[model samples]
Target: MAKVKGEIVINSERCKGCELCVPVCQQQTIAMSDKLNSKGYHYAMSINDECNGCINCALVCPDGVISVYRVKLKDAAVA
Candidate 1:
């Protein structure tokens, strides 16, 4: 079976620095940015490539700024 991978997109401008999604992510994929957004608030961001599309962050976000995309990669052939 192919392995699953995921990526997340966050709308920093809409984020309100709530940080609600930070601890809920099992993969530790989400983090708060040091910089502020256009709204002058810290926003959630995806820190790494280990996301599994669990949608925990998205579900927890009150502003609904997080979006997750998942894909499956086929295994490489043996040499």
Candidate 2:
């Protein structure tokens, strides 16, 4: 099986800083941004490129602010 990587996108403007997405991410890829959004809240941001596309964050996000994409690692052998 090929190794999989994930890309996570968060709509910071739409994020309400609910912190729901953080705990669900086992990879700890998501975090609250130091900067504030237009709504004056610390929005969610991708802190690292370690997401595995589990979609747990998306499922827990009440505002639908998260999107996840899965990619097969180029060097990984496929069977």
Give all TM-scores, in the order shown: 0.88, 0.88
Which 10-residue span in candidate 1 carries the lowest summed lDDT? 70-79
Q: lDDT tens string, model 2, 1-74?
A: 42888888899999999999889899999889999999998999998877888899999999998888998777
lDDT of model 2, residue 6 = 88
Residue-level lDDT of model 1, residues 1-79, one tens digit each, is 3277888999899999999999999889888999999889988888997898888889988989888898876566211
Error of 2 at 7 (Å): 0.5
lDDT of 2 at 73: 74
Reference-based lDDT, each prediction: 0.87, 0.89
RMSD of each: 2.6, 2.6
Candidate 1 vs. true structure, TM-score: 0.88
Worst 10 residues of 2 by lDDT: 70-79
